[model samples]
Target: MTAGRTLFVTWYDSNHRSIIPVGRLVHHGGAEGDLFEFRYIQGALEAMERGFQPFIAFPDLCKVYRSSSLFPFFANRVMPTTRPDYLAYLEVLGLDPTEADSVDILARSGGRRETDRIEVVPAPVKDETGGYTTRFLLRGVRYIPGAEDRIARLRFGERLFWMLDAQNESNPSAVALRSADKCLLGYIPDYLVTDIAKLLEHHVSMNVFAEKVNLPPAPLHHRVLCRLEARWPDGFLPFQGEQFQPVGPLTAPPTHADHALQ
Candidate 1:
């Protein structure tokens, strides 16, 4: 795994189509294993007003706390210990099941509706050119007929807009993809939500467009392809496109066998 990966706490209000960044978790690598430091962000002021306190046991909001273990706020994302447990967790996120790591789960659930209002999302990982690309199958085609014809007419790289679909009955975090005329194209995949949501929340410049559109006789969800490229502005701090390092090596808590020995 890469190093320097940062995780953030974000609050998504589906009613207002808003994402508020509340806090950040940075991994300080060392031999103590999985150590992390937590701090709140300015965007979290609203949450603070609403009585949501920091996860660490601290009285000062400006103070930073480090733990050689996972904090309770983030431990929920890493608690599943079995396949069934993992699947159940994924179901809560409205994601299809597969073998996935904590990072994958975090990325997918960052945009999850059924989970808590605040979620943990990994910061965008940029490529060598200080940019990153995201590819996803378009969602919500069933709601719009004639989408096939409309998609067929779209040219590659045609600009698209990502907006929060506040009125979506199915998922609150449903991000709608729109054309220049504001026609609904589809949605960003569940997995891509965390990164894209954070980018939008922070007012980052992103170039989004239709990458590919499959012909009919195929599933509607898979018919339209979309992509988002980060156009990092000069001196954009969040655009830290660097290798991610793990906080520390993780060791499973003692199991029944270990208890028996003890």
Candidate 2:
């Protein structure tokens, strides 16, 4: 039963502290273009909330984590506070040299706690169908200056990665965030591309609740995702099939729906 779980690992630092509390960040995106990784972790947390045991791995800094014991909640199981080398930790897990993906890692422990640590969770979303009964709380809003195309699609397992910027006119100032259920998704990527239409049929963009309460604006990185999705071509698709699927509502309001206009 423990054969098919996924363990999501993320690395963080001072920048993450600016967006949200270091503790709540376990489920939120951290600095270093790791939002995609956090998306995987969010799936795990949702699993835990649904009575499933989920395992998440994060670095335990002496300055941050007070307890020598990493395991906090029954749902949130922490790995041993070893050093942060990827290959070395793989060895510590006693895994084979050929194992590259965390999906291959078996749950080492027995019982419930063991199973929770390895299973993969799906992203919480309300598809166009509006079928599922669950409603996940909206966390932080992120603005990616360059990821419009990519974030707009919001498909099954898509991930966004970037750094934090506090000086934007939208968010007043960089403040330490503490809410456990929500976080504003933000990241600064190393690369940006503009001409996404060369590779894809449709443009991508998101309608986020702006400071004006109900107004949803196309986020900053909407351009970035569009460009990356366009240039990379085959790299973005997890499966080799039809692409350009809309991840959110089919018809957004006129003002918020147009990323290409802005």
Candidate 3:
């Protein structure tokens, strides 16, 4: 048995390689095991207008609530019981066998030129001394100052700047990072607020830095990847598992049946 984990719902536009965050799923320690919640974002609603309906009941904007026991959106990500089935799924996703994280599958799925779609996968949460690190593939690169030039100089495992924007009207828990020269970069995803915001409110020592910098002409949104490292007085427990099992196949179909927009 291990600590529970957090999963994020993201919609990928393969034509542009852009990712739109839709909802989240948090599976914590409880007798119920996996309590699922799904929320629809503004982007999801817009997608719906364009004839995209990923769920039988399209989630309301900015609202959060529990989902059904056998939600296919989550069930498809859980590792299949049989080795052949697991390998076959990976092959369909064009993923390496070792790359088992459902989030990775979701990310890769965006690169295809077919249709934009939604996926549920694990969020990146790493535990360190008295704190933990959360990573984001920085968005809005075009807004940063000479972002392309600066990113060219950044090496692997380099540190960048992180600052919180409490006044951000859209989301109060917004955390932003900048370049070494103090130019604005991008923000931490909205899904991280509940946990990361608590750490900030307690005056926990948090460090923000650059983990990886992918230069252009890569997709504008995913060019620079950043990380937030928070240090608390008490150590935090990170979620353990390469794959998340919320619901098994016995209770649901093999694929995300609800997300298949007609």
Candidate 4:
């Protein structure tokens, strides 16, 4: 991974353990109870405890503000690009999107009571090679539990987002946090996906897993095609793997992964 890519952090209130993002998954969700919030607080506290100052996203949002009480140790500044995606998932949870501001934090900081709210955070924006896509550090990283200090020192991140490619979706965990036993959790906004093309490729990978989600085809940049062609003895072709088996007689277009490490 190159330096200064964007990371998106989102939390879902479910009982599944954190899924590791490797191979094809673009995002990860499926945390349970107050786990998302608690882990976020842990992420923040861990940062401050390490003697580094912390920058905060979602400052206008209550859960983020309340998170401050947990660290009374570090100061936080608002990061303009940090957008959280909890509002969308809250509806799926069958709960009203509660604001951390609506409740009194003095009573809830350590209480860890159900606040009926979810938190979302996005990495600062960057390009495929981890170059800054936006001004400032708005897209540097998503939330990394227990990694504030380490991330602070590194430009890109040693952290990886662990989500199953939707193309490779799997059965939900055996545990039950929802009323019914559910399977196929799709969105948990973790990891820093800087390459839109790579993200599109990951979506393509997800095609093998879930058919319900809408992932569209991506137009490859000419440079990417040239790079792919340069790599092959005959010419560039789609990567063939167990899940991403190609169908057409024609060659496959280059994906984000093809040009990622370049």
Best by lDDT: 1
Per-residue lDDT over 51-139 for candidate 4, one digit per residue giving the tens place of the 0 to 100 score = 42222333321121212122221111111123374343222222244543211121111111244222232233324763322111111
Q: How many Å off is the CA of 171 in candidate 3?
A: 3.6
TM-score of 4: 0.18
lDDT of 3 by residue, 99-121 (tens): 45543554433322223365554
Tens-digit lDDT track of model 2 for 107-226: 221111322223221212233553211111122334333223323434422333322345744433322121122333433221111112222233333222211111124223221211
Q: How much lDDT does each candidate structure score? A: 0.59, 0.25, 0.53, 0.23
Which 10-residue span in candidate 2 carries the lowest summed lDDT?
Answer: 189-198
- State the displacement of the C-alpha of residue 16, model 2, in Å, after optimal TM-score superposition: 5.3
Give the per-residue Cα lDDT of candidate 1 at 102.
58
2 versus 3: better TM-score goes to: 3
Cα misplacement distance, residue 54 of candidate 4 (Å): 30
Deviating ranges (above 4 Å) for candidate 3: 1-5, 10-54, 57-130, 166-169, 232-262
Question: Where does candidate 1 stray beyond 4 Å?
Answer: 1-3, 13-17, 30-32, 50-60, 79-81, 85-100, 111-115, 134-176, 179-227, 231-233, 239-262
After superposing all C-alphas onto the true structure, candidate 1 shows an RMSD in angstroms of 9.8
- Candidate 2 residue-pair clash tally: 34
Tell me model 4's lDDT, rounded to 2 decimals: 0.23
